[model samples]
Target: MSRVKTAGALNKYLHLPLVLTAVFILINAGVYLLNTRAGILVSGGLVIYIILILVIYGRQRENMLNDLVTFATQYGQVQRKLMMDLALPYAITDDRGKLLWFNDAFAELTGKDRKSFRKSIASIFNGMSPDKFPARDQEIEYETVYNRRDYRIQIKSVVLDDLIDNSQILERDDQEESSMLYAFLLFDETELNNYIQKYEDETMVCGMIYMDNYDEAMESVDEVRRSLLTALVDRKINKYFQDLDGIVKKFDKDKYLIAMRTRTLNELKGLRFNILDDVKTVNIGNDMAVTLSIGIGANNGSYNRNFECARMAIDLALGRGGDQVVLRDGDSITYFGGKSQAVEKSTRVKARVKAHALQEFIEASEKVVIMGHKMMDIDAFGSAIGIYRASRTLNKRAYIVVDSPTITTKPFIDEFENNPDYDSKMLLDVHEAKEMVDDKTLLVVVDTNKPDYTECEELLHRTGTIVVLDHHRQGNNYIRNAVLSYIEPYASSACEMVAEILQYFAEGVKLKSIEADALYAGIMIDTDNFMSKTGVRTFEACAYLRRGGADVTRVRKMFRENVDDYRAKGETLSNAEMYRDHFIISVCPSGNLESPTIVGSQAANQLLNIKGVKASFVLTEYKNVIYISARAIDEVNVQIIMERMGGGGHLNMAGAQLPKVSVEEAVRRLKRVLDATIEGGDLE
Candidate 1:
């Protein structure tokens, strides 16, 4: 092929031009000879000179062609020898990816000889096409098909200089019309990748294990039996980590720090941290079972940073109601094994201590600003009022921030706003609250602990000293850097928790009828009129409010709905559908209700009265946002289901909202979660 192409090029470039020059010289010589004898002699000399030049040009062209052919033949042999002698696997392919040649290493890598290298290199490797190959010089990592081995590949397109040690080829190799060849050098990376994976699997990880109900469990048994119960619990944990070669040390009476490798941690994640159930079986004559909250930090920073991460993880686990494992990787968090409910503690020591600490913060601040969540419900509003009364007892100027009140709580707020006996100046909007907040001001967040869910996130940011008091399950995005945090998932409502705090406030401080009534109504509404989530402490708080002149008859009248609202409630309930025999799901269409959240909760509460119903879900669409209210009986945990959708509450009742989705879509999503929960044996 090279000889044919060289001959044609030589004929076109050298032979044709020589023939034209010879014809012109002969014409000139003929004219000179016919015109004059002296001119004829001059033309003859010119013809001889021209013929000499032509002879030299032809000889030079022929010699150059012979050198090109010899170089092309030698270049092929040199390239072949170089490819064959390379230590790493190497292959050469044509412009179409057809394998032209391969070295012994490549043949050994593929378990084939040179004779079998007829297919495209990609076909033997991993079906790679020519277009996928690097057009310029590059190094890439890939895995082969035949032996499934990894390799670091270097590919370079063959250029003129590449053909013969800096010698330029006649045609441009970069042009599409030119036939180009690519060379590939593959270095085995399978062993290196295996070592890297083994290092990651053996990386050190730190974890903190907390006994969420340790105090309660220890109190349940006698002093003589307490040591025995502790030994049993310790044995269970030690035995679980024995095979992993984990190091566990008790940091406190109820806390432990564990060090283990990532491989063991992954195995524990696969088991869903079954040690929780194992420890629960160690009964110490307690009515409530023991549980643990574990925090794990993996692939984070160094050892110290991982330990700090573990501490934060355990705090999140406890905030989310204990009996769970929380894994932290930088800003990301994952939860597992939160099936059990948080056990209620019999003691109020923590509450009293928090109340005293809150009082000190209030007394030290120049002014106080109280706020609750957006679309403030009774529990949120009522809790704010309770804190307001506490602030008044300290003789400090305080303000309550409410941007817009919900329909259910608007009546109580209006009554408070009209009463001159109370300080009407205390009621303020978000703008006024932001202006009032300063470095010395204390911002007390009530009902909701999440910064995004507060009445005014800007106001929360303006104040230096802040406090968070909430009863909902601690979500992943709780407010950070609070002066005090009093989150009690075991409490029935934030109102109930606040009411308990109010009893331990400054001596002789009492709540008037209207203030007491608001707090009482908050408890009544959240507890479904004391029909659910009522414990001994829940009733005790209610009794304290009644003793302070809370009028239940008037509070009941406050919750009474008008004819239109009652009809909307009926319409929402009428759409209820059953799934898996005991689960109820419903969606309230848009434009049918002014207070979709309230009606949805009412409908969900109503669904529980039906026979054989284990859980209920009511979805309401208002202002392009779908609000879901979930309620469950003893056998089901609606909080876990709601948390999966980024909402939360207690185990029996929870709520979530989906923005920019239709009611039908929300219902479909809710049903899919319910199906998975049932399929996984998480719900009945």
Candidate 2:
């Protein structure tokens, strides 16, 4: 091979010299035709000239090759020297992620001295592997945090032929084989991130603070000392925000507008917004303590949008019965300090006004379609039935949207089935209801304000006239186009809210015995037989139902479960497991059970009776969805817990539905949520 390489190297240099020698030889041959001795001498001279030229050209080729090889070696060394001293963190790794070479900046970033260590780059940076990189164009870029510093990593791939073609470290024989290597450049971004965070912290945030129950609280005190109480409460509020570097302007006697930096908002969240309780501590011989509803908005991308979000958040906070803070950050809405029970209002003015609005909507609409939640429970169906009766009385064609109700609601449905007093097709399926809806149709959503939880979400979009009446605390997903939304989180049951609305719906509105039983059963079941959340208005609503001929004994008989359901409830209690030393977790038997969720709720209530138990959860696996029923006496706010799990309800009574999970997996998820809640200091 050496001999062949030498010959090949000398071949180009010899070509021109040999051609000139060949011409001299040809001239000698032509002269030989004239004189033999002269031609012979010329031929000899030509041969000598050819030998001299080949020898000289071969030596010249060797010298030139030596110079070229030396230059290539020096060039490779210079390139490597430049990379080694570069300020930017640079590294070269093989396809297997083994570091071949690295610059000084890379050594500094990795906190390692220059050495011959061929360690895997994975040890320095986690989740980085050549196998995970994109194949096309052989380039990748991403951001990562290392050693408490942010870095933007960029890596480019190169073949051995291009990257180290003239490298002196490898021989020409070794370069015949092809290999791949990665060049990485890391940019430190810690200071950039800090500056960005500072900019974000300085962004303006706005809020609305309203004195909840201001008139009611003022009336409870004497007219003489009311001014003092108001002043003290105002001072408490103003001082609370002023200490946090915030601006407060009292726009009304009971309302204030606030603006502050986002950093202050974060500090407020960390403190859990104690202002809700601070305002209540201002006691100067007043019979009632004042409560406040604070709503703050941030990250809406515009100042005006932040104010709009503040308005929306304040409305949501008030709708959840006040005494809370709702933070609307972009699309996320967070609740803080809602652990207190909602204060019940003694006056029914809002209910009367809402009833008049409902009367107007129903009377003017061409058709009315009442929608309850899917898998309707007693509260949902009863509230829906109440609205149906109201629509019927208004002389409009009304239909109740009922799709696959639970077994608990089957009894009421059977009563109205094929009856002469009701329309044959009064109860509509989801498909049938969608076809009946139009722009002029009135869509009244009862029991649930969440659009996804409604009987038919498509119907809500099909009609422009939509009214929402729910007793559940509003969560992330709700009807956005509600013409008139009447939500009272303090109410024991949605049926109770509807029952109150029905009284003021018309001059003389009456109910049939069955209808009254349905509504009464709803209140009975939701309030755990008037033993859980019953108040003055709760009992008054029941008394009103009694005056409407609702028989308690008959309603109790209607709620009777089958033998299988009775056994399932017993099984749920038997399988109950204690968690975190206070919460009880149980699973209701869902095998061949139609009303598993109702039985689960009943079982949850039953578990709460255990001594030292703060709350109870019953999970039932039905049709590939885990239905979780949570119940609390007062210590635990299950509404917030359930809401964090993508569900919402009253503080004491909340439920959630998780699809495509096993009963055991559902329990594990519940445990994870409980663990996170405890870590977040939201629970005991």
In the order shown, what is each candidate's alpha-carbon RMSD? 8.1, 5.6
| TM-score of each prediction | 0.81, 0.87
Question: Candidate 1, 465: how far from true, in Å?
Answer: 1.4
The digit string of per-residue lDDT tens for model 2 on 1-684 reads 123343465556547676777688779989999999998888888878878877887677767667767887999999989988988999888878999888898998888766866888988899897676545357889899999999999988777665465786864456355577788899899999999999999999999999888888988888999999888888888899999999999999999999999999999988999898788888877777788998888999999999999999999999988999999999989889788778888899999999999999999899999889989888898988889888888889999988979888999999998578989999999989989999999999999999988887888889889999998888778898999999998899999999999999987478988888899989998999888888899999988889998999988888888999999999999989999899999999888888788889999999999999999999988889999999999999888789888888877889999999888888989999999988887863
lDDT of 1 by residue, 1-684 (tens): 234445466557756656766787767777776777766776777778777877887577667767878998999999878878888988888877888888898888877678765778777766578777765544444555346767767776774344443545543445455346788788788889889989988888999999988887877788898888888888888778876778888878888889999889888978878898888898868655779999999888688888899988998889878998999977889888777667777899988999999999999998899999988899999999999999989999888998878878999999988888888788889888878999999999999888888889988678779999998888788889799999988888899999999988886359988888999989998889888878899999989999988998999888888777788778877878888898988876546456768878988999899999999999887777889999987879998789878788888989898999977788888888888877876663
Q: For model 2, which pairs clash?
A: none
Error of 2 at 362 (Å): 1.2
Which is the leading candidate under TM-score? 2
Candidates' lDDT values, in order?
0.83, 0.88
